[model samples]
Target: MAGPLTSLKVLDFSTLLPGPYATMMLADMGAEVLRVEAPDRVDLTKVMPPFDGKISTAFSYLTRSKRTLALNLKQAEAVDKVKELVRDYDIVVEQFRPGVMDRLGIGYETLKAINPRLIYCAITGYGQTGPYRDRAGHDINYLSIAGVSSHCGRADSGPPPLGIQVADVAGGSHHAVMGILAAVIERQQTGAGQFVDISMTDAAFALNAMAGAASLAGGQEQQPESALLNGGSFYDYYQTRDQRWLSIGSLEPQFSARLCDTLGLSELKSLALSQKPEDQQRLKTALKDKVAEKTLVEWQEIFADQDACVEPVLTITEAAEHPQLKARGMVIEVDRGDGVMQRQIGNPIIFGVKT
Candidate 1:
């Protein structure tokens, strides 16, 4: 509890990944987060199997360093208890559908009235308004609706299902944390807190990033495997002879030159940045063939000292054991509240302060 946000307190009323993940990050940075869960509610993370001692392994990972309380919000006493807690826990995070909190008599307006300086953040799928506001959606649905699926994966195969929950963690969780922190800064100046609206879909829609810029202003509708970075050029992944994937990101002329020369196909260096579809495809074919000739290990040894940005696509276990990641302290063991210690991925944020 020695990080930058040590003085901050949070009351978490979120169920699944987005809200819970946000609170986890806040707790990691030394915020005092009190998780208020309904005793009868079935949190997937709590009952999804793979137990760590007495608690769910996923639950153990997500709820680390946070105090927990169970309350049935249907009871007036529970609502009053929450209202009482709000006096000190000035920041509130809830993931219920819009109006559900209002109906429960513990919404932002109600709590904000008690503490005019309360920072309330609401995270939902579509948002507090719009036709899809009340409609349910998962990470894939949000990403699909946001046009992220349009230009990912092979054009013939459509978009591949990603292992990660891009919308939930990246879109909802990250954005909620950013919004809450921004609101905190604003409150410092105004001496009054405000509500933060975080819609997973809205947030995912904005993650299109440079591709979106192209479509909106350049009037270029990006297609699957059609863009420079996506998979159109040699910047994509190539399968090694052992079926292991190698990511070739030799985008710059210097890097691609090094890549072409090191692979003994220096003649292709001129075509590395070719915009013509035929030449780009040809260059890709040659690089793919050359890379496929070697096993992942063989290629790794060849490029061990190369600055070509070529690297092996590692599994999670391999990644955890990688020298660079190990040096960066990306994995650690933490107590699971039951005093049972387990290894989990460490937070990626590099904080200068000890926590």
Candidate 2:
């Protein structure tokens, strides 16, 4: 079956997580993606562990459904070959330091001259033009700069989040993909392509929209785990008797009351009163005692029939093997050219066509 993006072609000159992940998403949707890898630069995913001994499981997941071209752009022949490829490709995605592409003579300006209809997306830590554009940074630094890290962990701890790669995946990869798709749509109308400069820091800033609004309205910069969504007893994670955790999302008073009723804590239902400072603390204490009374399985069964929005906190492995995930095909096994197969998170979109 033909995929939604079967007609599109992408030349991906990106290494590591963000760019590769974005291109991989497009490739999963049947976009003809040509990943340009350097012959000398070892694929970092291959260097890291959790491999299948012969091939990197991480690399296999990200590079699937795409053709790999081991090209060293420093070579004169490679440059000419890339130029020729640029003429036919619909989009070119490069995630390099600010000046690296220009130094290699494959910058957006040069590529756009060759193919004015090309959608060129450049992803970087900062951006192509900024005071700190040349500064090197990773996901942590970008999140810190965007104030995303400040709202991450527990109120008493200064530690950062470990689960979400907000800057790389959410900020960089998703932002670049959105920009490229928008550019593609705009190109159809204007018959001309444009440069999409995606700054990881700027993309991360998008996540701080709510916090920024709160700050603008004279609210203090709340502690990480003390915010309404983060700390409120009715809205956060709670540990049960079995040591497993369950998440409570009773943000509304009615839902919180329903949750309290389900847990047989009618007296604690009053804890779900207005979100005032004192009331929030009372709710936290009440929820702590109430949730501790049951195992995670018990709580799951208790809230199963209710719309109190409660769910067990699943580990990564458990989440991957979840029934809903299995039914939706969210976890798929892909061949990595070796004898072994690699498990990967599947594309979330359900397209009418397939490739």
Best by TM-score: 1
Candidate 1: misplaced stretches above 4 Å?
353-355
TM-score of predicted structure 2: 0.95
Which is the leading candidate under lDDT?
Answer: 1
Model 2 RMSD vs true structure:
2.1
TM-score, one value per model = 0.97, 0.95
Give the per-residue lDDT of model 2 (tens digit) for 254-287: 8888888887777877767765778777777788
Tens-digit per-residue lDDT, 1-355, candidate 1? 5578998999999987999999999998989999999998878899878897778878988898899999999999999999999998769999999999999999989999999999999999999999999998899999999998888899899998999999999999999999999999999999999999999998998999999999999999899889898898889999999999999999999999999999998998889978888888999999889989999999999999999999999999999999998988899899887676799988888777543
**Model 2 collision count:** 1
